[model samples]
Target chain A: MFLESKRGILFVKPMADVPSLTISPSSKESGEWVQPSPPRPLPISSLRTLTIRRWFWWVGVSLVLAVVTLLTCLGFGTESISFSRIWFILVGVMLGTESIHVGTDPTAVILLQVRLPRVLLAFFVGGSLAMVGVALQALLRNPLADPFIIGISSGAALGAAIALLFGVGISVWSVSALPVCAFAGALLALLIMYRISSLGHGFSIYTLLLAGVVLNAIFSAFIMFLTSVADPNRAFGMYAWLMGSLTGPDFFTLGVLALYLGVGLMVLATQAQSLNLLTLGEETARSLGVEVERVKKLVFIAAALLTGAVVSFSGIIGFVGLIVPHAVRLVVSADHRLLLPVAGFVGGMFLMLADTVARTALSPGEFPVGVVTALVGGPVFLYLLTNRSMRVGM
Target chain B: MVDSKNVFSGPAYALRDVTFGYATRAYDQSESVLKDLTCSIDSGKILGILGPNGSGKSTLLKLLARILRPERGTIELFGNPLSLLFQADVARRVALVPQETMQVFPFTIAEMVLMGRFPHHRGWGGWHWEDAEDWRIAHKAMEDLDVTHLGSRLVTDVSGGERQRAVIARALTQEPQVLLLDEPTAFLDLHHQLDIARILRRLNRERSLTVILVSHDLNLASQYCDQLMLLHHGHIVEVGSPQDILRPDLLETVYGCQVLVDRHPQSGLPRVSLPV
Candidate 1:
């Protein structure tokens, strides 16, 4: 019956005169869709489920990639430990199913004692810095924000240098003096910067950046003074560490770093929703019932602790914090719920890869991990500066 | 209605001898922005605040939203002194849609509107990302503002008018007793202007929402607003219904310009036109 009407045999109009239904209503109506009522907003439950699924997808992918990268790093290095031997030692020790003598194999000793600790330390430092980066970016409401940009890491390096130069870091209660001093220095710098930037009623981005630049200058000068006056033998080590190495940290220090990272990550993760609201702008966030001042205080201190702890051990590794979160954001939603955890995983993988290159790229001597991060990060930073879409939050 | 002593139970908002300014010395009397402003806005009515630039119209709206504190005198919201209420409590009852919003982070329109539910989800209630009820309210608000289609689009990627609609949707999600808007029509075209006005009118009638808007469009304000307040030089020059305040002489004196006033052809509401 509908076709007969369209054929216009029994209808008033002719069949050839029928307008094509295939043409969009837009092209039909004044050449416009005027009021093409959009579909009803997606159901909240569906959106929630969608994001949750996406979150898991990212976690799954990152987890797989991380496992592969870690396994690869474990096998390939200057010493070239056989994969099966390393695997046997790991499985046997973890499962306690097979006998493995550490004294019998030098490669096993190197793998279990030296290389494993270094790789684990690198992962923790990288992950903590990336988490700190995400938190600081949200706290400042500035996309360009990073621990290094704000000088938190520099303060830590200064503290570490003081401890090493003076030989004051005596092992106390299994906690080294260097990391403790470094954490203290990080907190101190954060406090000073916060005070200087908040001198006015509102937190000014300009003031914060300016204060960071000035503080970084002063601390670097102090570090230079210490290095210049130190004895020749110690000064060489100090300068190399200052260039941003991932060396000297033993398993005990790694355990302490893990404790700091775990606590900081928990604090930041619980406030993920608040951080999402905060990026909208302070006044808007407050109107939405966020205790703006309280959240700011919590995030600032947490980010500082994470950055400080990592910096104390790793010697002010730059760029991972700056590059990792921004890279993760390009692939995932900016919702902190997903951004934080994914960034942590990706950052760990990235630094482990970088460290592997640093150790193996040069056969006998290794380059500082910081140098590798900068060599990779400098281009990404330039791209962000040139990208028009990125200019919004800066 | 003009008599100060002829008071009903209470209006949605009551301002008594309210004074405010920004960064002025305590002793500098000339620096005050809104000086001795007194008025009452009734529930379920649209109040259009009209004034030239720098005439303290925006300042008055901000004071009402509690974005700024009054330097002197008291402002009451539903019979309670605004000063005595907690910030979140005030936010629950009142919402302000600023003239413009800047977002540095990229968020989908859906996520942006969900933020409106923030005030309602307080204490331990917000622990779960957002409840089903919150999403339902946000969805309904987007539907009301005719922005449900743009829900999945990035806010920065949409047009200015679409973004404005989304912002209005967010304010609706707040579900407040009083809605304060600064230049709601500034970025919209003719169709959207009327669409927004109709939405406000429907909300007023259906939900008994009290709307206070700051607008530069004289005719639009005259046609839709139940009452109008004309401000000049940190003071309210006139406050009355559209017919009483739409006079050419009063507009000229306040605007410092020449203008014509006439009845709209269809609605018979008084319309102000610039005789070019």
Candidate 2:
């Protein structure tokens, strides 16, 4: 019937065209399909469900990955040392057993002070970035969406550039101001984008994505101008940051990042249900009793905080935020219960792994982790993008 | 579980001659999306809004949901003005089921459906086993929609028709006073469309749930709606019971197409046919 009526019937199946008189429409439907059903999360109710227990697998793997990442990061650096000595050195540092030197005095110090901090930063940053990826992906409702796409990274860079070059005299007690600057910038950009894309009625993702690209370019240009005008010394520091390094940031910065990341992560994770509804779009989300705007505001703040803090301290570590969330979604589905946390774990491990390779790929000189992320993520992302499943509009 | 009479027990919803428009761009001058639109909904009985494309069907729904601020009007939901309710408070009374059915994110059906409980819920925890009841309600909604088997399957992997039902299931999980569905059957085949129609009918009759649906399917509207509103160029063209409004003249004026209206043999509801 379809082929007879339409000229552009590119392909047709016998069953698709012919519904025989003998077979009723109701009878043709073999399965007793459930209609609009309720949400049932990963069943963790009993030990019997342990094998299929997805969270347990993530937790078990995360611990092992974290430990291995820690050791490998310490083991290979400017002066490569044995794995045993690296472990002993780490134990000594933890236990305050400062007497065991495995080889050169310089290598031991480098292992303890230089490599260890960088590696741990990678792990923690990875974890935080991935989790933020999950949150932002759910919040935005576009798989291609990320913290960067929303202009959070650009805003953070702007805030950091002003602080570093102009030496914005925010006192030590207002020490929280540096990251707060980044978070504020992110929130401000997000507000503008939201307002512009959603004037009245529903949001158009194409318009939003286009808006983001324009905003990103504008901010990137501004940052470039800041770099060009700054003193040579400041320019060098800015260069390191723009390329994204895991080098600087003291423990105080870590403490602050942890605090903000913790609060944001908790908030996003708790609203996992809303995030789930959001994937169905705003109207549906609201009907499901989600305070759509409030959820939007909270998730944006959380995503901005996560993105802003990371960019402020570690500089712009690109692709981890973009890649980690997609990876997690493919493996675990968009159910935020698992998606949010797993994105974090996977992100942490991925960054740690990337940073480990970056630091050791060439012993004396260091490579930027962003390059590694893009190199790894580009191919994988391409595969997902061109896949048959996504051809239909979401 | 909600009683219909209690919904408008003391004047639940009010919209006072609101006007909305978009600013002029280079190509087009300022234009109104909703022109002096004034309407109110009672607590019970599903309200069906029928219109052609670009006729402000979505604009009307957005105003009610408060996602988009109306340009020049006052909207009151359940006695309190829209401005009076906290963001959370408004969400408790109304829920919207949007049109986009294709889901890119692979949310499990359970997690997707539990989102309906967000207004009734608070705080920021990942998933509390203690909130097991919310999960149960979501599961029940899924069952009500007959989508229980697709619970574990990635939402991305499902058929378009199945995904649409899943989205509606999520909305049902919200347990709202009013349910607003925009193009609910836009993505479904005939079988699923009828299934949704039946489910919606049951919810309206049994629960007294107020349903406001924006659809292109005039037949479905005539069959299910207590009231049918015709819209054209962002204005309500005609409104009344299906029998009164489903005339050929108004249908042509609003839709810009030839339409034939006939009475159904058994139900006596208006049935519509369009030109090929």
Candidate 3:
């Protein structure tokens, strides 16, 4: 039945012509209506289910891939170490059998002390950023949402710049102080954006996004002004950090980062089902028994925490958060329970590879890992936008 | 399991002096959408709310679904104040099928339907995963809605009528005693509209589900609803059976347009039409 109005004419096909609405046997049983069955199911392949077993399978595969990527990237720095030696060193350290003195052997020192910590840091930071990306995207109901675009990274960067400008020494206190300041900055940004967006009772996604963009610009200006006024020697270091570098993190720093990321990821994981419901719509989620306000708050804090933790140590790495989750969603289903873990592993692997290239591509002189991600992420983002099959709208 | 039909002994919903308004930019003033409404909806009955645009029909349905709170009055569900009940508790008894929803991700129809079981999950930690029984109920809802074949299809990729069925299937999976629909047939064709009406009637007969729907289709409402209510300017103009409420004078006043009222030729139900 076509509907014609003064505004325009809408030609709706007759019910008999629409295959999806064809009368079914069950409906026919209720009355005298008889119609042909719906045509063969659309040729599109059915979406793969993430059963408990399949979820575990995919997670295990991604975990193995991440570990392999870590180990492989460890073998790439200035002084490349053979995989066999790296494996031996790992086993020796774990089993406590080989008394390989790290100070005496440069290879062991590089593999265990320098390279090992760096790779592990990369993995944790990457995983944290990606997980937060997935959460933020779900929270905002925008697939493009990520820590960097939403200003959390710049907020952390601003905090770190202040700490450095004040000449916070590299003592144990400074070690804790830098991250504390960054986390504080991230929380402040989160609160400000949340307040601005939620002024009308509930969050408006457009308002939240606009606030994030504006906050990012303001934070960047503050960071630039601080850097310009600081000493050139310190300003150089700040510049590199602003560009997002993962440089020389120790085991203690890695452990602390792990703790923060662990807590944040656990909080996000517990809200996985709620996240799935939220993607449908806030009212729909509320009707489905989800506490929409509570879930939003929890996810916001957790995402801020994860972003701050990673940005504090790794400076502002871009694209791992935005790209990894999106790519994983394409391969796996959108079920947050599976998407979260899988995206984390893939992100870890992605950043590890990017950092490896950054460190090794320029010989002894290394560039910021953020440069590599931006170079790769920029093109990939464009491709996703232009490619019809990417379907990145969500 | 106990039958939900036997669980509730009184009216499904009762609103007393219920008033709702949207706060405008002016701090001291507000625009009232529903004003001082008092009504009681019986169980196991289909109630259709009819009104012109902006008449608060949808707001009334939302209030009954517990999705909105009245500004100055009380709403009771199953003899208990709606405000006193937990959100999940309210959801478990009352399910709403919105006219449309924005889908940010491509969730499979089965996954979408399984979400209806969310209110049934136990525990405050939010760690509950859907078990076999949840899947069974979801599957059964799909079968009942004749959407079993669309289980693997994405809700975003389907036709409007199919998506509507999928959404209704999800609502059915909630296994609620009362179902609230906001313009369920607004965008549907005649066949699909009839299909939806039949499904609602069947559910009402089988499970004693109380259905309250808001619609502009006067003819469809008259054909399906046992009780009809007309509203104008946030006030209830008339509430009665189709025959009593579908009078030309009442509809003309509520809708602000002249309408010809006649009986449906086959069913003898009230039929409304615009006299061109």
For every candidate, how close is chain A to the native chain A in TM-score? 0.84, 0.80, 0.83
Question: How many backbone clashes can be found in candidate 2?
Answer: 31
**Using TM-score as the measure, which candidate wins?**
3
Question: In model 3, what are the clashing residue pairs, if there are any?
Answer: none
lDDT of 1 by residue, A1-394 (tens): 2321222222122224324346565578767644444453444443322255677898899889887777678777778877788788778668976433344567777777778778888888888888888988787776666788678888888888898889784567667787778877887887787666445434445556677778899999999999899998898988887777887667777788899888878888878878887887666666666767778777777787787678777787888887898877655667788888888988999999999999999877889998899899878766665767655533
Sort the candidates on TM-score, descending order: 3, 1, 2
What would the TM-scores of all predictions be?
Answer: 0.85, 0.79, 0.89
Which prediction has the highest DockQ against the true structure?
Answer: 3
Candidates sorted by DockQ, descending order? 3, 2, 1
Instruction: State the lDDT at A358 in candidate 2.
Output: 85
Error of 1 at B265 (Å): 2.4
Model 3, total clashes: 0
For A234-315, candidate 2 gives per-residue lDDT tens digits of 8998898777789854556567778878987887877776677677766655544456777787788887787777877777
Poorest 10 consecutive residues of model 3 chain A by lDDT? A1-10
Q: Give model 1's docking category.
A: acceptable
Q: Each candidate's root-mean-square deviation in Å? A: 8.5, 7.5, 6.5
- Candidate 2 has a DockQ of 0.34
Compute the lDDT of residue A347 as modeled in candidate 2: 85
Q: TM-score of predicted model 2?
A: 0.79
Comparing 1 and 3 on TM-score, the stronger one: 3
